[model samples]
Target: MQREPQVVEAKQQGGSKYRYRILAMLFVATTINYMDRSIIGVLGPTLIEHVFHWTKMEYAQINMVFKFAYALGMLGMGGVIDRFGTRIGYILAIGIWSVFGMLHALVQPAFGFIGFCMARAGLGFGEAGNFPAAVKTVAEWYPKKDRAFATGIFNAGSNIGAILAPLAIPLVVLPDGTNWQFAFLMTGAFSFIWVLVWIKIYKKPEEHPKVSQEELAYIQSDVEEGEIEQEKEKMSWAKVLPLKQTWAFAIGKITDAVWWFYLFWGSLFLHDQFGLDLHGLALPMIIVFLIADVGSIAGGYLPKIFLNRGASLNVARKLTLLICALFILPAMFVPYMSNQWYAVLLMAFAAGGHQAWSANLFTVASDTMPKKATASVVGIGGMIGALAGMLADFSLGSVLTASGKEGYVFAFAIAGSIYLVCLALIHLIIPKLERAKI
Candidate 1:
């Protein structure tokens, strides 16, 4: 039998706990990233009704600009991180996004909607770097067995960010939407603090003085699964883009549009259907994302349960994804509910399910691809997901303009059903989650 790594023993035995610090930083970064992007969403209804007075189509166009920029950023940022390493790559990303995020305050009414789109596009591009750097960081610091859980822990930050938006934004922006610009400025400023700490604290696991031999061994235990043949060489998209494994990962990400819808439009839905104002929207929105936070952590943990029970990695990952998809099926009924809280409950399940699904879906890349290529593959998948979001935004914008509240039925139905289809397609693309030859 293979010997267990000494780091698995109790910390009193001198096991180093430095990797958890890395995970914590990732969690904070993700939280700030989501907070920066989600500010617009939390302020959307107010902006549309009281401030910008934008039509549904115009609002959709603004979102489309962000998605388009995000899609392009994903394509490039993945390659940049893969080439430069996560440390510098992450700094560059956060720096760009923070500047643009704060610039939202500068968008004058004279510049009109075009100004907001410009700021959002910059924010989108910078925010695109987040997952690529984060996933690559996880792959560097944790073995495959722990990666999903680590991912889930950090991924939960998205929900926390979403939760914080309604709670905090209401405090910054008045009920009538005065001082709305402060919301973006305040949230965007957080990264400067994070960057200072990150610069001092971060280094490769092997190189970091705080990471002990036993802990380093623990981190490297599964390295052979995704062999690092050219550990120092940069991965080219030419190498990974052609693989079925890459497509499997990308296709699985098509459901990201659903998650984006929840983040960007869920509050609006609540406002329109249930007549909830900023404060009234808080409790339901908080309830929805808090449940999602649980799902994110649980989603990462569930596969470990299956793994311990003697299931194959392929089976554990796919089965967990299946459970998550089933949880989302109730979303179709969200638009039909007579009670607002009932609708909130159902929306919570769908949001939670998506977070769970996202946690596993992210691990699929590192599970199958080389560690060097993790960011690149994740970037490719994110780009595809962003493109999918753009398409959804276009459809939603046009439909809501023409049909008003009725558009939600179509939206919920798609969100409820697409997961199973994508899951089916993922299975068809990669029958087993074997490591890619690349």
Candidate 2:
């Protein structure tokens, strides 16, 4: 007695399991991507200070340079990946970043400030492609219904990298005072190995021989008829750039970079302010980042809970992000605390909240754009964000130098509260976060 449409629906429901498998490999790729990028940050305070005798302000200046290079890199990588698709573009990105990640081991003090900054800058440029490609791939693989969760899983790789480095870096050694350098080399080798695995595993949705027809229908069916009717074909940035939605994503992405830039460099901040040794809270960023991983998925999923209960994705995403942004309030107090655990707890909460906000922010890109341009738009947004980070670092670098270790209270306070303020400004421009016609 079932109608033809009913029978088709049942058939479509038959192959839901394969979707998660496709998402799993993408998640692995992202984790490795973040891991390689962060290895240098962990080693920066200990190795750089020991070898080069640089002040905290000098290190801060170098971080600012990395941010500038990374900003340009994201702008370029997005365009390249948009034209070429994720496979070839991602392979190039992974290979370049990983090579330089290991290249740090070969660097000596004689290579000095410019050489180290160049190496970090090179790493930043290559690492720039990661988000755009990963976000684009998730759009290709998962249905709209599943995309938020998929984004959370893959995006959490940055945290996973932060987590793993503490354990992995401490394992490597060299006869010289260059044990940290060897850690960079080991991580670089690890990324190169990941390149092999990524190539073996990735395929286009249509080309994936193992993908069930049922799942394919599910993915295609989720593409709204409105999206199909307006412009089914992919458009370049020239066509997409004029839209307000693109700008919204750009603002959100820039805001996102601000939050994570804080995490990536926060270790350096603590090293300067609190005198945390390699054995203390400094190296435990792995544990700190692992805890934050919970926030990434939770932030993504929490909004869906609201949506399933009838809230708009726009409403749920922004409201939840506001909550995440507010987590910085406590972090402002950590720098002033006498007890180290208080500082650690405050930093953990702030980082975890940022990860949660990150999960939802990325989902906004996929939510507001076509799958084809999700990464490209995210790249544009990332470029702006990288610049914002440089500005923040440049200002903070001066503060650190003037006040010495004690100057961090202002840094933590300002960094913590930026998200709530940024989100408010962004919403004013793109009130509904409506997807643009591209």
Candidate 3:
């Protein structure tokens, strides 16, 4: 039997922080990922619905197409990344999504819903690889303990993308000469530049010239002494689906459904409830996503503090999630708040809580699974999450069609309480963050 490698006894090791450079790259890719996905959301009410004269149900149908495609994409992309490795897999994903994002600008009201649906579907498929590849990369580059913080740092890119979308999309409009299509064209083109940088810079830690010996040692510090480092065999969906750890990640990801709603609908929610136009939404949306940015980093670090105090990994991760769940509960009352700022504050809390919760939840895959299975496992979880988002989008559309802004009362309530239930379910499923026997 192979012996586990003995971990270095020294708690501290001085090293170059080259891993952070990789984290920065992941951050940029994720930022572009969201910028492309969210450009539509930021413009949904102002451009897609109002300017194009589509109904709420039509808008929901378009979002449903994206989420459904995202769900399927996650399932496929996870395995693709596992097989192809992050560098190539990530590049492929971004390349596909960027093309589709730019294609959105080419569609006109003449082509109508079918044309938009096709573009959104393609965008969702390509965007699905972002997390699976990113989480896998983190597993490859960082130790178990630092993974969450690193994930949090990079995950904040979503918010940065979200934040930038509202601001940048408007800037691209040519005043009297152009429209929303310009925003899609500009954001879609931005990713190709990042692709060039990523290709030149990214490589496995051992192979990269920029990574120093000290950093390599620190990166490998999690491996126990005498452990055999064999190449991991490819994991199949059949083999991975039965594992409780996979479900824990999946079920916990239901919260992302709420996030998807926030991403696609938050601006619309403001528009419906407060009569905010596109220009009116810029500040509030920025504030909301900016708060989430803080939550992502804070959530990532909060668990580390507990782990440092000698708590078990399970305790540290779950406890942070529980706190984040509580933070989101107040969001349920936003519909009743009457005061717009008060409602915005509650939404901020929920968004921040979700980000914080997400940072920890995403780390769970790498924490409990082998590196080879990391992307596949993340893909499995993300697929389920996207499906959940699809259901939420469908339901919200139906509800809003019937009740208008009143429908958000139901949506917010679900968003607020769903995380606590998910946390409970995650605990019931995994109980402890044990490595999969497979």
RMSD values for the candidates in order, in angstroms, are 1.7, 3.2, 2.5
What order do you get sorting by TM-score, best first?
A: 1, 3, 2
Which structure is stronger by lDDT: 1 or 3?
1
Model 3 lDDT per residue over 1-438, tens place: 212223332322455677888899999999999989988788887665545667888889899999999999999999999888899999999999999999998888777688899999999999999999999999889888899999999999999999998888667663322577788887655788889988998988878898877677767777543322532477788888898999999999888899998899999998888988777788889999999999999999999899989999999999999999999999899889877888888998899999999999999998888887889989989988998998998899999999878899999999999999999999998889998877
Measured with C-alpha atoms, the lDDT of residue 406 in candidate 2 is: 62
lDDT for each candidate structure: 0.90, 0.72, 0.87
Pairwise TM-score winner, candidates 1 and 3: 1
Please state the error at residue 151 of candidate 1 in Å.
Answer: 0.2
> Which portions of model 1 show Cα errors greater than 4 Å?
1-13, 225-229
Worst 10 residues of 3 by lDDT: 2-11
lDDT by residue for model 1 (1-438), tens: 123644354431576879999999999999999888888888888888877788888888999999999999998999999999999999999999999999999887667499999999999999999999999999999988889999999999999988888889998898677998898898655899999999999999889999997787778776663255466887899999999999999999999999989988898899889888877888898999999999999999999999988899999999999999999999999999989999999999999999999999999999998888999999999999999999999999899989898999999999999999999999999999998876
| Segments of candidate 3 deviating more than 4 angstroms | 1-14, 174-178, 224-228
Query: Per-prediction count of colliding residue pairs?
Result: 0, 1, 4
TM-score of each: 0.97, 0.91, 0.95
**Best of the candidates, lDDT:** 1
Q: Give the clashing residue pairs of candidate 2, or none.
A: 163-286
